[model samples]
Target: MSDAAGTDATVEISTDGACLGNPGVGGWGAVLRYRGKEKRISGAETETTNNRMELTAAIEALALLTRPSNVVIWTDSSYVKDGITKWVAGWQRNGWKTAAKKPVKNDDLWQRLLDEEKRHTVQWRWVKGHNGDHYNEIADDLATSAARNLRDAP
Candidate 1:
């Protein structure tokens, strides 16, 4: 069941992250769509990195599924995409350490993401962001909005 944009191959989800500065105010967003209905979710952090936001977006998206189903996740973050699809296994085998023998960054979120991922079959795809993809654009907007909201919060 694919959408007009060929995004419905499975329940299609897209996520984005934004940070005012590398480790400043940050936010993450996710857009989930299935059978014509769409849901958007976003959150902000007082201080965080883009990678953490990216992982948070993916984690939140998967958490929304709530049922066992195949899914395709689209994201602009190679860190999120590659980290889960490529590096996770090795990390698990190596006691969650990186190739450089350093502790993996964002281990908490990464572990949570791994746990949530087990609830569904997920395929990670990289999308070229800011190129006007509908879901991707929506996600980016939500992330920016969240970041702005965080910055403006009293």
Candidate 2:
């Protein structure tokens, strides 16, 4: 899609992540929409954290785009939003260290997310999880199903 200004138009996306245990089996899901078309994608990991899953959702969603476009990404994770939009610059400047000078957790994923983010113009929006938002609920279901699938796998 292209805006009137000749720039790539915005694609709306909703993403969510779920974990069977905080540091155990986890999954991420995303829904993307543009010009009345939609796509859903999801994946799971045998061992991970809720935060990692959350970040993964956004990463996977953005990575699916075939071209650089403006994107509005809806997520329930303040950590993903704040960490990327607010804190990442400082973390990069400090060699990926937190305020306490400790190494940042999930630095690898964060770096990957940042790399994917650079490919597009993304606006991060936060929605309350499980609050009955249609897309959010759908993404949640996808994530939960992925987690369950992984857990049930031999």
Segments in model 2 whose C-alpha atoms lie over 4 Å from true places: 1-5
Which ten residues in a row are the worst by lDDT in model 1? Answer: 1-10
Give model 1's TM-score versus the native structure.
0.92
| Candidate 2: worst-modelled 10 consecutive residues by lDDT | 1-10
Taking all chains together, the TM-score of candidate 2 against the true structure is: 0.95
- Tens digits of lDDT, candidate 2, 90-129: 9999999998999999999999999998988889999999
Q: How many backbone clashes can be found in candidate 2?
A: 0
The collision pairs in model 2 are none
RMSD of 1: 3.8
For residue 89, what is the lDDT in candidate 1? 90
| Candidate 1 lDDT tens digits, 1-154 | 2332334346889999999999999999999888777889999999999999999999988887756767889999999999998898999999989899999999999999999988777889999999989999999999989999999989
